[model samples]
Target: MKLRKPVIWFGIAMIMVMVVTGVVMFMEKVNVFATGTALSDNGWKAHFSEPLAKEAITNGYVYVTDRDGEKVGAELVLTDKGRTLQVEGLQPGNYTLRMEQKAVNSQFKSLKKKKVDFIVYDSIESISSAADLKLYFERAKDMQSVSVSEDMAGSSEKATMESAKAESSDAVGGGDHSSTNIQVEGVDESDMVKTDGDYVYSVFGGTSVKVIDIRNPKKMKVAAEIKPNDDYYPTQLFLHDDLLIVLGDKMVRYPKRSASQAEIMPMNSLTTIRLYNIEKPEKPVLIREIGVEGYLKSARKTDGMLYLVTNVHPYLWAMEEIEGDALRPRIFDSNEKEKEFMDFKDISILPGAIDPSYSVIAAIDLTSPKTSQLETKGFLGSSDQMYMTKDHLYLTALKYETSTNSRGAEIMIWNPGRADTEIFKFKLDGTNVEFHRSAELGGTILNQFSMDEYKGNFRVVMTEGNMWDERNPSKNHLYILNENMELTGSVKGLAKGERIYSARFMGDKAYMVTFRETDPLFVIDVADPVNPTVLGELKIPGFSNYLHPLDENHLIGFGYETSAQKNPSGGEPLILTKGMKISLFDVTDFHNPEEKFTEIIGGRGTYSPLQYDHKALLQHKKKNLFGFPVSIYEEGEKEFEVDFTGAGALVYEITPDRGIVLKGDLVQKKASGQQYEEWETQVQRLVYSGESLFTLSMDEVKSYSLDSFKEISTLKMK
Candidate 1:
């Protein structure tokens, strides 16, 4: 009996030891399972619990197959210390990542899991129906965990103006005159000031459009003023033949019922265009008015058709109580005599667009403004920069995705986990506009100048990463896409650690400037649609913000001259801007570009509107003359301080033989104890009519003789 009892206890003890050993072995076996998947610029990443064996990662052990189990040819790379398996070169579709048990070492296992379903897509998917859009909003609300009311706010409009071109006339004062400096030749943009050689039409004090007769330079006088109602304030003007088009903002109020039953009214802003018959300079008659709900994004006139883009953000959160037309954008036409909401059939969603906003585009037949109809369409998305050709219009939007880290903290990051630009293209035919394909590039565009369309291909320059962030320094890239928005060629990883300051695309080549400690101007050859290469590079001491073509082989750069100073923080030297710089670059040699001439003005605190607004510059190509308004400041006795010197307009004659020569200086004298610029006296624009040059400011307009540089007349505007 004693022997039986002892054997029972011994068996129980053995069982316990076996259980403990099994548990230890299982814990050390290194079982792996996919935690999640992420998309990057290079490829798709399948994250696992533990690092994998390098030799076991191969097509035989790890591969991707389509939804039907057909194996896809892709390059497999083990990254993140074998914790991530990268699958590249796969087209957009649903796929399954199959990792065989053999992919793990003999001492490891895969938790008996063989496949992980995933998707490889680069484009955005459109919302299928109203139900789908509601689901989208619900998902967005769930993810954000915030009230939509917090996202609602007032939006401001941007002023983008252009110059005017007049036909050659035989009148005494009608000679070859300069128009608004523009990017495209045939595309006309609206500006605050426009001229038709004999008359200058300008927006004065944002209240009225003034028609100044410039036929007699010494007797320049205001001939007429078109003043609108208090609700409409003019911002820009465009002159087409005998028609004067004025663009401004109009305020509309919506009555909101309060909790106490009181009516509270909120103002909403809309873009309005007023067309006037200016056959007689003295008496202007209003022809018609066109209005669209939202803030004006941009406008372009070509082939006697006007295209307007506006961004409309309605009270989407009000969908909880209100529905239908109340949340949709509206359009007003004088012919209709009433405002109408946009049709649902005319509204489409951009792929991956999460913002509850609409980009409304309207086409007006300016050729017959009196009886023409308005055709407009709305897209649910947001656009930052716009570029257009005679046949196509391109809009770019920056999209960000939300991701969670190891700590479960949500972080907002650019789409694809990099700085990406989502671009949409539209085909423009006369007064008809249609949406084309869209694409996603791995960088952010600088401005409208960063994009261009050539013979059959579209090219763009983008800057990736932040220049101030050392961990992921900036790098520039240039991409070429086909008419269908398919990737054709690219020059990636250019100018590492520097961002693009300026980019300009010529016929067969592209000029780009990137800056950090020094400016590196790159000349890229893009003639071959499938293989673009860097032709040359020039490193200089400053950067260029705007680039203008002087001729076929020459270019002009406008920006700031910078110098390196010792960094008190002790890493890289600090870049100290010295003065406003003008450089003429010679690229006659495709393999070697040279800065032929350079001119710097003032020191420390010198600025010109031409640096930010290209229309502020005056270019007389016939005379090889260029001028802009500048506010000059000099370095003070204390460190990091400057003293205001003066403000005025300066003109220079730049030629290949003579280089850069000062032609005229019309600086306004600073009053005693004037330590800052006077807004009223600051020159804002320079225009030339025949042999006379006019400088316009808020207070007055002054005319100078182009031949003698003598002041002829001054007309008070205020």
Candidate 2:
């Protein structure tokens, strides 16, 4: 009897011990690993001294450490220069010496909390080097190992705006360069999800939108796809709780002129703004239609307010009918330029140009007034441009009514609330032939022509090849507008305007990145907006598409940082460099934003200053420069299934950090053989509500669950 009792006790004790051990290990999610022999003795693989390759390595996550405590704690990543600590979005300026202690040890198992103290050197010199790598967070909710976050920034909220601006300030935005890591809380892989390229069919025009529910990322299902009304063609879709507002061109019953124009040719007179009641997302109902006199092309939403700042839509590319066809110019005496003339410039002038149409600022107050407010949107120039800062909306406008071409476009500020909308306008005026030209660059425009606001001033930056007598920088301009929307000051004649493309604002300075030539980044101290001085320049090879400012001293540049002078596309020896890299710097000394730690974690994609949860969606290497392409990776599966159009996207899990998951195929259809085949069909846009990834391509909206990345439901337009 005594032996039986002892044996039973021992068995119970063994089971209890096993349970406790499992609990401990499960709680200790973070495991420190030693330097694997897989890593080459040279540290970096042979060919990747370039910034992009280095960034990919840094992002590759050499080591994964967890903060064993609350939501906040230090997560140290292995860098060539020991362990660098970042806290509260700031680097602690701490360092270490030849600190090779237990290269990979689970000493963290003893950590009562994630907070641990490591050997530190406060000196800046011993800090080794900064991360010269590009960073981006691929938010994948299905895969926790990726640690990407979503629900960080909302386009329509002020808090979202401020934080989004801050994200831009981070090296991601090129404002603050001292910060390196963009902690994404989710996983972004080419697989892990199945984009069963099958979608339902519909032929509805623009009145269609895909409805999604984003609370539960894992089990999300497509509730419905609705086509509110037939006549209204939606141009853009913005989410508002249950309602999905569609921005489109509508025909006014009283305004017969526009209706008549449309009757003449369906493409002539287009409507501006319209609203749909999406309370039943699956079955969208038309609440009311709001149409302005003119047409609208592109649109964006931030907060509950919808800004359908009107612009011209390009549908006119018709040639003037020739009375008699002849081949020769001199032989026919018809004064012909070319027998087969491909005229793209004149296309904008025909029926597509916005020179004749004016825009309106319609604040669709979804929260307050049932009746939407409308005002003359007094801002101009053309399409593919326009930005809002503070309460003022800056746009490119022609100097006066006399000009015809884009060179007439300059910077202007307008207030939607104000009755007299034209607050101020800035331009560099000169004579072209016999006409006075007042435009962004005084004559012709330059690269990625854009406007940005720093402190209180607005600066215009772009790429210009050659201008007038100058060959270096085509043109760059800076204009300061006060609270009254009046130009308080201005500056022109940029030194490196020709090569630059993307730009961002820091405290009192701005950074401009170049695309062509010796693409170096230039810093401009705009303390004196009228006479802004160039701080210094950081040169990297290839083009600089976007700049994410981590701090005043460091900036993360995305886009290919080529190894050779000529690009691989130009018959040059293909150098497999880092597609995405993070470049750190000591920007406290902005005289020159010094390159510090540059780690290439992966490839580089877009310069979207995106946030979800708390982490930032770092940088992604773009497979294609022009279009949005998504690659899929199955969970626990290695390798990617790259799909161009069916590039599924899910950014619904917005939270304290930048974490969200985007997966699935782009060309989503429900019919057999209707799968996403790049050669057969093209895909449009994608939307997400946690689990169900709703992809709206062409007339179809397909849904996929986050748990299995499988297509669940599909809605075709009516």
Candidate 3:
């Protein structure tokens, strides 16, 4: 997961006094970026140079950092063509590096500041990685376009003079040399897990967990390491049967315009719950991990039943133990009605109604009045719940209204087999539910859903609607019940922004998978169990998140391509887009559904999809071709391009074998499987048994060999 370079952790005499006080004291360090210099609307062309920058033009340059904003002391060099940035030994205070004062070509210009303090052992130095790769090509000139290839550092093919449109537009034409996205702030990472056979698992920081055994995918062996003495980590998980359910420290969803911003998740790591017990194939037994008492964030489990939904903590720990010792944080227990939290900020609702949250985090204080420790400025937060079936633990609740205008909350079905009860709460009768603020372009607005169904009846199917109103979707509310609990009634007009990620009823029509501007597969009728009618929709361009039904008239839609584009020559492109079809479609004409087949998986042409979230989407069709495990990095410098997502969680299986680069049956040679491979160190999640595969590398647990795959020993999780 590593890639967090704010120079590792900022502070080299406050970045040599903000880069020698922004160029000897502001007056010439405005909006600077070099490689070729950027900030163009057409006023700063071709940015990518080292020994290249005299065709000069700049209203920016001067930088330094270390308060968590690395790039210290002096650096504004193009050293004849190799670029240079030697900022002395470092040790300063006030700093600078400002850019904003452009009318020359307007890409935006309105920021400037340059403060100084330079005083480390005779003045800072050292900026050579090649002068920090030439100020990262002048901050990749306005950052974020990622490969359009004009020469983009040569080598994706295109330097020929043998023109014929140079192969019709310099290498495939849609144009992109692939490489850019440098928020470079600690190497932009979130998930990493790759295994066809040889073990690999990851879940880092915010807390930690690891395991590895590359089984010779070339070599990497580290097996075993899981820490949680009680600090909080593990944000998402699901591995039923042998039991291994973990989901901690969350901020998973947020956009319903501040869903009551409190960012909860901390009390003894959310009441601490690790619970491992891998039925020992080679040894995996944490035995029993239970840290009971509410506030637990997101989780899912079936064939065992454990539905949960809680963040009701408003108790404030007996008055911070009588004031003066005031601390915060309360882990595991979003269920059981437990309540005693302080702040962690959580507000997700994109499928409908919920908002409020903008900077609030404080939770800490496990069980015994554990002395002082609550220094939160870190902004750690969490939300989003679903424990599909292991007894049904669903979540989404509201009741802290701030002004009125609708969408408050109510939808939290828990039934861990009764002993852990709550069972019902659909909420939303309208007094005026407005809840705005989550339109970050397509993410939060309350749209929870559930269905793994062993016998079918109804585990969950949430909603909130008005998703820009796409043809009246029955308005909202469709709770259908069955797992022997029964409700089977209340499927009304739901078509606002369509929010039921999956429903597939069929015997009376149910389809579902709704969204507002994209991601559609609607088709409702519920056989009229109460009032469910929409009967036709199917958009599909990207954003279905997850869906599979196969029987009942054939239905399967994985589609998920994120958005954001404008280049004909307008530039601002930023795509990471991943998750493509296995599609199939044939809803027996849900209003005309007949596609039959399509398959194209993995990064290609991506121009705008800002990472798309809700854990982006994973699969559990058990096996028929469903994938979600990624690791694709377009990586650094074209200026603000930042596309190195660490790349690795890729669980591929949809192969009748046509091409993604295979053919090693054991090895006759042709193996390109397109793997991510960028590890120097850092892996903390991956699980799968039977054919073999397991991982975690903060300490232990490594086994592998799904055929010819490698890596064999290293157990410990206990």
Candidate 4:
């Protein structure tokens, strides 16, 4: 057929385009996956649906490029059975990652390549203005709507002066004076027991606060029982002059959409505070009550002001768009007619935090009337650990994203890689809370005991390591941050193979215990905040889960006794914890710390509340008395079978010179083989008033003579 030159050329071009498009579509069959949009300065990671051959990945299979499509020189490695890839040496900026899958499954012969764009941040960026925060929230709301699979569900403060006065009387008085074994001397930690010469205020059964008359220790009686709403569970209590404050959490459940349909998670925790007028012990009156949306993270009382912290994870998934007003946390005051939502102006967000969670800090005046106001500051993050000094409140939140392929292909994803902790500091002055500064640090903080402020510098101890990386063994770190939350000095690279079990900072000296197969008690000198030094180390047979300072040079270690077994496959030794272990560490000589005295109790499964919660430890240093709850687990004939050897309080006479001497065991009598009964008694706390020592359980309170450790009286709580 005869045709014009232009028409013939157009027909040829169309045929060429169709052929190229078909080839491109076939080559894109293998999906290259990127876990998240954000990358850390450390590096970026990518994943693939199927494993890749090592040779294929090495020969430029995965690489990152800048905006101009120019290849960036970097090191790429395959992990997780060659299913995951990581790229390092990239700076903080936007970059496009190119991942090429050269080999497909045996069933398919074609392979494809994909590219993804991501941003690597140098550090957490705080919102500069309200407008910026609102925009970030909008983006977060939209991103959250795209449901991530359940297998990928990896979502990761201050001292007050009322404490200053309380510190002066921390020592055990001669006749009947005793106080809570607090982390810091003058800093009063909220506990179940608060004594004022004649009466004892305690939290009982998590359902009510009990006030007992201790004037007659031989015949202790319940003076008053203060109960809150049905949904509230009282956990801790604080007392100030004529008032008693109860701290707890209230869980609210909602009706399901349909009776046949399963209900959502029932418990929505809200931080609740209840103040009672205890002037008349027989008739305690509820003076004030407040419920704020969020689970209580931690709270402290200082200088007559109560600093309360709560972390709220809002139900933003149910809504299409992020509601700015709904984000503000709600608070209820007894004086108010109804619960009121906090003003948006009162809420503040730090830069670099793009998440929608709320970290609310509220300061309440203890002396204020029922109509008193509360000062609150809210940030957009979730605080896991709180460390508060006399003048400042520190909120620490660990930020991390789930990398499913960090480990091999398993249905369940484990939290691997180390987390970056975002620390938000707030200055405290009476009833006012002013945001001071914010900074980011590496590793995860254990608890409040993991942090301390000395000489205007904050000292924090954290364990650093990746669960997936065997080369990066867990190590403890002592980071010294100034008042501005900037790192000034650090004592890193400590206990390479072990993680920090417990840490305590006492003035110029710090004591830390790390464990793997055994315990290594390290004594670090912070006399120079800029050049902190580890003076001595004491290796013991067990790990100390908590460190309590006895005096200037003495420390009490509460933990478990563990034995090491050689791995049959010739890998690292496996540590097998056996029983409750308490060690007395003498650091009188900084060059040589010694575990002078050790106490091992029960058998393979013995458990003690003291090993987990510091509040469970009761000690009267001056009286030379220490005690904690013990649930003896005696061994049986079979490996799995265990015999419960009655639970009770184990008391000891602890002294610098005499060491730990068992005074007696106040055993709670119960029927055999009965795991729990109507009046099941598991001793949890111990306190002393006058010449009597009191042991507290969930169902009853028993008193004993301090001098002879003889049973005196019993008060039952039902």
Highest lDDT model number = 1
What are the root-mean-square deviations of the candidates from the true structure over C-alphas? 7.8, 30.7, 28.2, 8.9
**TM-scores for every candidate against the unseen true structure:** 0.81, 0.46, 0.28, 0.77
Order the candidates by lDDT, highest first.
1, 4, 3, 2
- Tens-place lDDT per residue, model 4, 522-611, is 888888878999999988787887776677778777777888888899988777777788788888999899999999887777877677
Tens digits of lDDT, candidate 1, 502-600: 887888889898888999999999999799999999999998888877776888888889999998989889999999999999999989999999999
Candidate 3 has an lDDT of: 0.34
Specify the poorest-scoring 10-residue window by lDDT in model 4. Answer: 157-166
Off by over 4 Å in 1: 1-175, 255-265, 317-324, 402-417
Per-residue lDDT, model 3, residue 50, is: 21
lDDT of 2 by residue, 564-667 (tens): 44554775344433243334444566676655554332233312222111122322222100112232221222222322222233322211122122332332
lDDT at 177, model 3: 13
Please estimate how well model 2 matches the true structure, expressed as its whole-model Cα lDDT.
0.34
lDDT of 2 at 458: 54
For model 4, the stretches where C-alpha displacement exceeds 4 angstroms are 1-135, 141-175, 252-267, 401-415, 566-570, 675-679
